[model samples]
Target: MTDSVYVHMAEYLANPGIIGLAQSPGDLVITEFMANPAAVLDSDGEYVEFYNNTGSAIDINGFTLRDDGTNSHTISN
Candidate 1:
């Protein structure tokens, strides 16, 4: 969950401050990612999975997923 997220240019990541206690939605962590080599599109079987530690809803309306340094995607829904 150490992703560089911004909400209207404001850092929306859970800033657990000094003690390192995690905040609400930040508890949702990336659990797994799938990557496989396919005969056609190499990235056809790629996927990511996340798990929410807290039983609360999270609003990621404008969150962006940027990894790999070259490709990025902003969540719209």
Candidate 2:
């Protein structure tokens, strides 16, 4: 079987207003990615795109991404 990742919205952090988040499986999807680009540097080339399957727009603030190695990142805005 294949592995799958799930995305969930957070309802915390001085949220001034209601921001929709992934409520269940399949609520978010990796729509596109670019591991390598013809030009530009790796920082400007490698990328991943996510799509919201829900009706409302979801806020990705406070989200975190990491790998088995020392690579990690968090969305602050």
Candidate 3:
């Protein structure tokens, strides 16, 4: 994604309340991130788990994952 988009996302993720979407009650939470494993290489074993504390399902089609400000992977449906 472009730098502007990255900045926007970073801002949103950092404080959803800026747009009035606070994390109170329920929200998608990153519960775990496994970076190493005995059964596989770290690259292959790495995984992130998210939990939707809300009662309904969440649509994460355009969500993005970034390890740093300059790089990102967008989730595609």
Best by lDDT: 2
Off by over 4 Å in 2: 1-19, 36-40
Question: Residue 25 of candidate 2: its Cα lDDT?
Answer: 64
Candidate 2 lDDT over residue span 1-77, tens digit each: 54333332345344445547665667777787654487976667777689889888877876765544456556677
Looking at model 2, report the run of 10 residues with the lowest lDDT sum.
3-12
After superposition, candidate 3 runs with Cα above 4 Å error:
1-26, 35-42
RMSD of each: 7.2, 4.9, 7.8
**lDDT by residue (tens digit), candidate 1, 5-63:** 22231235443232322255557676776544464577767766767676666555555
Clashing pairs in 3: none
The number of the candidate with the highest TM-score is 2
State the TM-score for model 3.
0.52
Pairs with backbone N, CA or C atoms under 3 Å apart (clashes), candidate 1: none
The digit string of per-residue lDDT tens for model 3 on 1-77 reads: 52222212444575565532324544777777654477885468766687877766655655677653565666668
The models' CA-based lDDT, in order, is 0.52, 0.62, 0.57
* Candidate 2 positional error at 46, Å: 2.1
lDDT of 2: 0.62
In candidate 3 the C-alpha lDDT for residue 16 amounts to 66
Give the 10-residue window scoring lowest on summed lDDT in candidate 1: 2-11
